[model samples]
Target chain A: MEVKLASSYGFCFGVKRAIDIAQKYENSATMGPLIHNKNEIDRLQNDYKVGLYRDLNEVKPNDTVIIRTHGIPKQDLKDLRAKDAKVINATCPFVTTPQQIVKKMSQEGYSILIFGDSEHPEVKGVKSYGEDLEDVHVILEKSELDNLNFKHDKIATVAQTTRKKEIYLDIVNSLILKNKEVRVFNTICDATFENQDAARDLSKEVDVMIIIGGKNSSNTKQLHTISLENCSDSYLIENETELDSSWFDNKKLCGITAGASTPDWIIQQVVDKIKKY
Target chain B: MEVKLASSYGFCFGVKRAIDIAQKYENSATMGPLIHNKNEIDRLQNDYKVGLYRDLNEVKPNDTVIIRTHGIPKQDLKDLRAKDAKVINATCPFVTTPQQIVKKMSQEGYSILIFGDSEHPEVKGVKSYGEDLEDVHVILEKSELDNLNFKHDKIATVAQTTRKKEIYLDIVNSLILKNKEVRVFNTICDATFENQDAARDLSKEVDVMIIIGGKNSSNTKQLHTISLENCSDSYLIENETELDSSWFDNKKLCGITAGASTPDWIIQQVVDKIKKY
Candidate 1:
């Protein structure tokens, strides 16, 4: 059996930068899980003493606090600064761009539409930036647009950095059809595109596909969904222990891809474990 | 045969306003044909002494010039004013909105993409408003997007008032897929939507469809195109004289629609002639 890796996968620029920033400040605490990967966060804690605080209330006045890659809401950041905690922002630039666009467009009197999961922290943070929160809408499906009644004829939309581009386009097309003025900002990161495209291309050539990343990672789930379209025997796992030996018994070629939050060390361990099959 | 008319058709607000403005100033000349219909222009000339000029050079000092519904270029308007001609701007507010957006977005360093015919006067005028004319592009088809290399990643797109909404959405979707930031202004008029939607609904119910307006009218052509999709026996004609009696020979019901440039008198003549069949 032969194993192939996707041409582009794992640890995107923002995640890598966030990890580096955390490692530099030993004994510091992150406002949230710095990245989605639990194993990486555990590693940072054990090796560098970088701890994760699930809530802002956990941070002490003198503690060093690192913002997660998904970013915290505007009020949360202001509160953290007001508490006198030393802060290091690790929010991805791609994520920040949409935040700025939402704030600017909202202030300019355009209603904001965010195409992402409403409950996701990234979307919540982005939604908070809108000048008029009442006019801000976060929707995961195009069908949800029907329920929205905007105060303004002008609409500005931004997508989560890790969302599927096809779904974003569908939402945008729907907005254009119904609205008078639509301002669409394609904020999905380049890394997401490259990784997903590579996974799709590799999955078609293999009998089975293995997607590795945090179970909660959006991009990882997106990769798994795309891979399943081309290869039915696709599985998403966080690490080597989740891989089933029987699944690869009849497969001649196996394709592997990892989400942006996945670390290279974890990918190496998965690859090494799969070799024994 | 029973004759039916689309609920919404003919003489949109802009065209009605232009005709009213043209009628107010007798012995005046329009920089271009006031509306697309030749018959309407001829009527204006004979009744109101409103003549037409093919070029700005034809305008004499002190000549009262009425701008067409589809605006002339910014420079042309300036030249007309500089030539001491009293210009009555009858440009549709819908069309003017896109021109203003393009000018503002371009001046703010965004590239302009006009999803319309390059030869269309409205598209040409909109393109001319871009601060850097070199960064403005006019395209009719989605495939044409492949050849365009925008000078700026920030793109502002606007459609011609009469363009099909589906085609404009296609162009916008393609642009969003390839670009980073896209600002889309749905400059398509409500009248176009109403007329097209009515034509589509009527065509589906009738055995034969008749679309009336100037042959060169974009909205008329769009209605004809849409009608042909639902009813194979769709015919486009400028007036009653062009209607074929044979089209009604076997048809139990005929649906009629007219473009924005079409006047009520022409629609009545067509309806009267169709009843004779």
Candidate 2:
């Protein structure tokens, strides 16, 4: 029996930087939970005195306000600057790149099409940049493409930074067939692709795979999906306590991976517990 | 043995109209071989003294010049109108619809993408309408779609009226994947689809299929291709004399279909020859 960890797992550069910034400003109130991992957020609150506030109005004068790694809407930045709160911009640079692209292309008269979950914060942030344009649309799935009836022929597209590369390319391929002109900007970050590929590679050789991350985290959910496709015994857990010994009853090999938002301490706990099984 | 004709086959409305207009003006010279059928052109030339002239320079002053069924370029129309020749416009309305759509869309600043053979007269005619515009492209196959790189996002597309509906739709399906915004105008005439569908239906129940049309006819070639896909024993013939009795040996059921330009007499002769076999 053997247990292995993915080559690329745990907190990415952006998430690491965000956590370091939040820890640097101890007792600070983040605009939202600093990251999707509830265990990490509780640790920050109890150990470092960091607090989570869902709304901008919760931050008082002179109180430090840290932005989440997913980034905020452009107007929110302006409104924050107008206040007396100490602002910490923790938006992932990879996510920022798409926001700027949407703003620039929409200004050039190209209609904007975003390939991602419309309800996701990262997608919502990107969509806000193009919301001022007359022909902005968010396509959550390929089936939604059939409902697109646009007067403007010019079109520019961007994907959520955490989206799968193949799904984005598949949508772009379909768009080219229906339109004479198309401009595509690959905005998905390297971290997301690396983590997904590593998890997929590990799952193929393992009998049972454990994915550790917040249930609400988009990238974590994506890793679980990829792992499950390659290995049906894949399970998503936020912590070691959720692990069941029955899952490893006859499993000779086991694989483990964590989402970008997951902390090193939590991953080590999950790995240590899985080894005991 | 059973011999059957497609429920909807023979000269289409556009071809019939062109023939009627050409026959009305005796001793007239057509701009090109008015239609694709060589036998029909020869019959008109010998029986009615109508001549086929490749160049506009061949028509004498005061001589009648009939436009071909596939239509001509916009510049050719201007050059024809500049002379003192009696002009009889015989451009097929179905083909003309795509030409006008291209001209209108291109004039409105939309880049035009045409799906058809670049060298075909109908495509050439449609391409000419948008040649004055900055961006106009002709894609004959789905493979050529990769070469399409455009700065302008607005895209409008039209297909040659005689093109197979499935081929055009397949290209459109592929284009939709690539472009953010697409405007599709299904320019394929009903006659082409009806004929192709009828031929395909007959081919399924028949042991052998005979496709009658000019060797150079686009729609006829499409029908032959469709028939061959369903029945490998399908054969394309220009006239009754080309039919071989050896092909009929062991073939219990035979289906017949003709191109839009093939005259009724040619189809009748081919049917009689096939019956005698």
Candidate 3:
């Protein structure tokens, strides 16, 4: 048996930068959680005085604030600033690309369609930027296509960063067949796409698979969904204790994968447990 | 704005099935076209009829016969009688799953590790049988643990139905700390993982992202990966004339993404067209 490594494993540039920044602003009264990863978030909670105010409503004058990697709603920032709070923007550059699209589409007065979960922080922030325009719709399925009358009027669309890469095209192809004048923006961050690709490539070589990340995190879930379709033996484990003996019984090959939010140390733990097996 | 389509997209289970069996039988002959992506690899080039040859020397009765999803791998009643023919079994279980792992792994005395490329068909195929393994390794970063040099161990590892997912793990924690018996397996199919996730997500929601495919084929570069990702603005056009100018203007939002193996489509078409702005 030959042990091999797929080449696409590492902390994405955005996540790495966010962590470094969070370390610098650890105790800022206005600092939000470091990132979406539970482990990282927990570390920030323990080491830093990150005030989880939820939204701008929770803060007061002179309160120092740290933003998460996802951008905040533009109005919220305005409101916070009016209250004289200090703000540290840690939104990723890849995420900023979508903001440009949202703002441009809104300015053009094209009806907006965002291809992401309505609840996603990135989507919420992008949507906030487009208040100058009247309508913005969040879509998840082909049925959502019916909402458009194919009026041949300009419409602009984009996506959440962590969404699956393939489904995006299926929906777009169908849209073009029905109407012209529909505009689109490929807003998915490059880092997210690379992570998805890397996970797909890595999952193909091992027997029992472990996808390490925060369980509630969307990118991690995306990795889990992609990994499971290819390897049933692949398990998404947020903690090392989740490593079960049954997954390792009498098997020679094993592989591990992680999402964008996954930390290196957690991946290290998964490696040690498999070595013991 | 300029649009770019990703280079990988849209692989079916049937096609991946064919590819997996083809890889294992690469040393010999394939039972049929390894996959359905005609634009990708020509079927005529990769496969041969199972019973056509007998042996490598005389090309007669005992030559190796490979298995394909459309046909049988183990059921060689006609060719088994041939004096010069041997059999190599490979089948994709989206069409079939083998129940033989219990007998095979137990007989071989190998610990099992199964890796699945997140979105490939071959990864799905291998994990179906890896349930009995003690610790399944389905990630790439942790593959170093798979290479334990235990003296008294027999292990068999298997791969997913697709390739490009074999990620080898790094043993940073030092497996020497754990005293455990081990066996390892390497099973990754082919370019399936590389193709599916890389291109599909970005194609949707962009203006005039071109998908290139053979007009006569299905699931080629133009079909699933291309047309599926971006719903509103994706174009599955084989060439440039199909692009509409109205997709862009002096001031507009635009994005581009692509499917896999669409080398026929020119990226300059997008860059030049968007530059009109």
The top-ranked prediction according to lDDT is: 1
The window of 10 residues in a row where model 1 chain B has the poorest summed lDDT is B159-168
The regions of model 3 sitting more than 4 angstroms off are A1-6, A9-12, A29-34, A148-152, A161-167, A170-180, A190-197, A214-236, A244-253, A272-277, B1-277
Clashing pairs in 1: none
True contacts kept of 2: 0.00
- lDDT string, candidate 2, A1-277, tens digits: 4689999988888888888898898988799877777778898898889898878777677888998998898888778777888899888877888898899988877778888788888888888898454577887677888898655666788777455556665666566556544666656567877898899899999999999988888889999999999999999998999998999999999999998878999888888888887
Give lDDT tens digits, candidate 1, residues A69-188: 989899999999999999999998878888999999999999999988888888889999999999999888878989998999889998884556788888888888777788888887
Model 2 residue runs over 4 Å out of place are A1-218, A221-277, B1-4, B20-29, B42-51, B58-64, B84-88, B108-111, B131-134, B141-155, B161-184, B188-194, B203-211, B214-255, B268-277
TM-score of every prediction relative to native: 0.81, 0.54, 0.43
Worst 10 residues of 3 chain B by lDDT: B168-177
Candidate 1 residue-wise lDDT, B1-106, digit = tens: 6899999999888888889899999999998888877878999999999999998999999999999998989999999999999989989887888899999999
TM-score of chain B of 3: 0.38
Q: In model 1, what lDDT does residue A18 have?
A: 92
What tier of docking accuracy does candidate 1 attain?
medium
- All candidates in order of lDDT, best leading: 1, 2, 3
Question: For model 3, how does the per-residue alpha-carbon lDDT over B99-139 read when each residue is reduced to its tens digit?
Answer: 24523664455444444443444443344344443433343
Among all candidates shown, the one with the greatest DockQ = 1
Worst 10 residues of 3 chain A by lDDT: A1-10
